[model samples]
Target: MAKVKLKKLTKKFKEVLAVGNISLDIEDGEFLTLVGPSGCGKSTTLRLIAGLENPTQGDIYIDGQKVNDLPPQKRNVSMVFQSYALFPHMSVESNLAFGLKIKKKSAREKQEKIRWAIDLLGLSGFEKRLPKELSGGERQRVALGRALVLEPKVLLLDEPLSNLDAKLRLRMRTELKRLHKKIKTTIIYVTHDQAEAMTLSDRLAVMRDGKILQVGTPEEIYQKPKDVFCAGFIGSPPMNFISGEKVPQVKDKNIMVGIRPEHLSVSLTKIAQAIPGKTSVTETLGSDNYLYVDISDQLISVRLKPDERIPEDKSVWLFPHQGKLHLFDKTTGKRI
Candidate 1:
């Protein structure tokens, strides 16, 4: 295991700043994920750590040693790309042995490492299979095995499961968590998928426009977002934003009230501090229903039980759960 640290790391593509000056510390054996929308620099940050991209400024340290000038091979870090990058003509065993062969390891050492990785990744039975013959998940496992056989101090993954189907992605997520537990290698993963970040990471850093907006555990970032963008971006179905003027109890005129769909309930009868609106649409997803209501000039979504049905175009009252209310400064977009 190794601790990875970045100090004021920055990357530029001529006139474009792909990664702004940012510093982060990844503890030994921890799984840290960099998550954001496309063009947000999460992938660039991971590349910098892997020595695939040179930093425009600042320094990178792996296990307390400065590696700014080290090449990727000398950095002792392994990376798994989105494409898997397996050789089509090579068998799984050969692909996993390629790196060790390049390093000219003893034949016994190479065999031992290959066997360990294949067994760990559940690829033992498919060692003789070519990449073309493997399923998507199996190919992904081969890619992972290829990286694991290298036995690097740090493992960097760049959206390694993005191409898989929904069910396969879910299964891979579980496998990855299990793999991390078994190996305990320090990891830095980059993905735009918030669900994957939340589920797999020990902690996650949310970035935008080449800068990190927030870094925290999934629950911290979810329940107590620091700003408007985070509050709106972290949750599923997104958070509902209402102008301060629309909420009479908001004392500050320059503030906006944010409430999650799950925190708002629709009521058939009148309730205190409830806003009246007409149901615009109702979406049923088996376990729960989402009710979109038009209030004033804005539309807001409220979560309801599957059995609770609000007819479209029918009037209803929406009430925010007092404990779950989030208030943000409208101008700065910062939470109050």
Candidate 2:
């Protein structure tokens, strides 16, 4: 395992800047994920690190050694792409052993490594099956095994779970986390799915247009985002951003307050210690309720308690948890 560091790394495809000047330090043995929407340069950066694409500028280091001139084969990294990139005619064992064979390992060593890899990935029975004969999850496992057998210093996964169905994706996610824990290799994963990033990563770097917007644990990025874009990006139903001024009530002006869905409290009337609002609409989600309220000339969402239900087709009062509110610089879109 190795610490991967990118110092002001940049990649440009002629006129368009694929990756802006970016810098990040992925700790050794850390399951670090790079997450963002499409065109955010997550994949570009990953490619640069893998030496699949050369950076337009900047330096890349693996364990303190500059590897800017090294090719992908010399980088000591394995890439697991979205496509799974499996050989159609090769059986699982052959597929896993192909790389070692090319590197000219001894026959006994190849057999030993293949056996160990198959067992490690629970692919013992499927070693003789070709990619076409295997299920999606099994094929994915084969791809993982192939990468793992290489014993790469770092593992680069680019949206490896995107091909799986929803149920399988969820299952594979748990399996991927388990694999990471057991292998203890430095992993840099790139994905658009925030939930996957949150669940699998020890630390996640949120990217936008080739720049890292924020880097933190899932809780930190969710509960305390550095800006509005991050607050809006990493959640389901996301955090609500209403264009409201600093409604000075008691202390400092809580200007451009951000309230997560779960941090809001709904009631028949506004509480004495919270901001007042008129209910716009309420969505019932079986165990929980979502209340949309017009407060301070903006609409915000509130999460209702388990046993509570919103009175239908009528305006209700909402009390926002002031302590949970996040204040931001409206002009700069930065946390205040």
Candidate 3:
């Protein structure tokens, strides 16, 4: 229920700059995700907001109040880490009631809150179960419920679903989206999984080397990436890049042309304006097939329907869809 803001926030670990100067504004009740590769400072940024780590420079504001000098307990923020830090020996209800007990809430108040959390998280039958008795997903919910019982003004999650199996992770994603809608609390999430970030965030801040490369909605970043790294990173199959000089349609030699796998079509025969290549491999993933074509020693992937099949080592041609090409500077890798 609060808006968070960062002004030139920075953190340095002696010789290493963990988080470079960066500014961001998270709207009230909005879910914002920071996504990037490992060591990209996404986790560091989340820790700064949670008061788990102090920033080297700049300020953090929550609900328009400067919180850079405040301790984590006084900041009204709750964080869930990659590992579900649940109390191993405690029952689910006890885990949920621990924070309320620390704050010395009345017995009735604690019971009411614990019941609410259990019901909210769909754990009605598992209240007496310990962490060891619960499934991975159930245990994760206990950790989340423990955080929620405190009614924090802001919730921070750092790769909270990374430990779950793929199917369980998908289910958790759906649960998180539903939870956000019901509570409307401001959430700042950090993860390296682009698919997870895209599924859960209202806005995404793509980071690289301790700096934010771009910030936008999932569709915005996917359809119109501002730079080469973003263009290559956000998609499942990822966008394919080719030297502009190798493309007959491109006039600039000092640039690179990017076409997503879905934006390129595979053809066995040469066509008008087609780029010739030899088929390298094909990957069938239930609903869709991905064809890899080697063009001038560079492999380009093309999306195909599940029914479509192309032989390996077969000569093929590629045709880019109109208006789908992305242009970037060869030297700087910036969008052109």
> Which candidate wins on lDDT?
3
Candidate 3 per-residue lDDT, tens place, 1-336, comes to: 899999999999998998999999999999999999999999899999999999999999999999999999999999999876888899999999988887767899899999999999999999999999999999999989988989999999999999899999999999999999999999999999999999999999999999999999999999999999999989989999999988878957899999999999888887878889999989888888899999988999999966788999998999999999999999999998
The runs of at least 3 residues in candidate 3 whose Cα sits more than 4 Å from the true structure, single-residue gaps closed, are: none
- Candidate 2 per-residue lDDT, tens place, 55-134, comes to 89999999999999999999999999988788898998889998887776789988998999888878888988889998
Q: What's the CA RMSD for each of the models?
A: 1.3, 2.2, 1.0
Q: Is candidate 1 or candidate 2 better by lDDT?
A: 1
- Model 2: residues >4 Å from true position, as ranges? 246-254, 270-288, 294-299
By the TM-score metric, which is better: model 1 or model 2? Answer: 1
The order by descending TM-score is: 3, 1, 2
Residue 111, model 1, lDDT: 97
Error of 2 at 264 (Å): 0.6
Q: lDDT per prediction? A: 0.91, 0.85, 0.93
- When summed lDDT is taken over every stretch of 10 residues in candidate 2, the lowest stretch is 245-254
Local accuracy of candidate 1 as per-residue lDDT tens digits, 157-239: 99999989999999999999999999999999989999999999999999989998899999999999999988888888889
Q: Which stretches of candidate 1 lie over 4 Å from their true place?
A: none
Q: If scored against the real structure, what TM-score would every candidate get?
A: 0.97, 0.93, 0.98
